[model samples]
Target: MDVTIQELKQREAEGKNDYVLLDVREDYERAEFNVGGIHIPLGVLTASFDKLANHKDDEIIVYCRSGKRSGMAQHLLQQSGFTNVRNLEGGMLAYQG
Candidate 1:
């Protein structure tokens, strides 16, 4: 599944933090600018799945520079038994901010 930047912003505006927002971008990219998602590089997502064990059933929104990497991250999460995962469509590049 996927979500647009506008939808994400609306979710934030509603003070909804119950879901997990995962940033699959690299450190440098995140340092440049980010939407305050948890910093977890895509390459190490599988290895770091344990960090998100508790969020398996929670809604997870993943984003990267573009949508590609985050889409991959979403797939891995689903394969690993994550019930609700969504890739940020167009990623940060499409963010209005």
Candidate 2:
């Protein structure tokens, strides 16, 4: 599933903290800008997935420059048995826009 920027912003505005933000962008990209979260680049995600075992059932929101990479990450997390992985629709582009 996917979450829109407006939904995320509304949650932030309401102070309803109930999800995890997983930024899948590269280090440089994150350095440029980030909404903040667990910093794990998608390139090393396969090797680092074990780091997220404790969050298998938690709501994890994945994002990148565009929605494509995060969509892939969402599929990967779902395949790996993560129960609530969601991709940020339109990714940072929509968020910044």
Best by lDDT: 2
Name the weakest run of 10 consecutive residues (lDDT summed) in model 1.
Answer: 88-97
lDDT of 2 by residue, 1-97 (tens): 7899999999999998899999999999999989999988888897899889889999999999998999988998898999999999999988999
Q: Pick the candidate with the highest TM-score.
A: 2
Per-model root-mean-square deviation over C-alphas: 1.1, 0.7
User: RMSD of model 1, in Å?
Assistant: 1.1
The whole-model C-alpha lDDT of candidate 2 against the native structure comes to: 0.91
Clash pairs for candidate 1:
none
| Model 2, residue pairs in steric clash | none
- Over the stretch 38-85, how does candidate 1's per-residue lDDT look in tens digits? 788999999999899989999999999889999999999999999999
Regions of model 1 farther than 4 Å from truth: none
For all predicted structures, in order, the TM-scores are 0.94, 0.96
Q: Residue 22 deviation, candidate 2, in Å?
A: 0.2
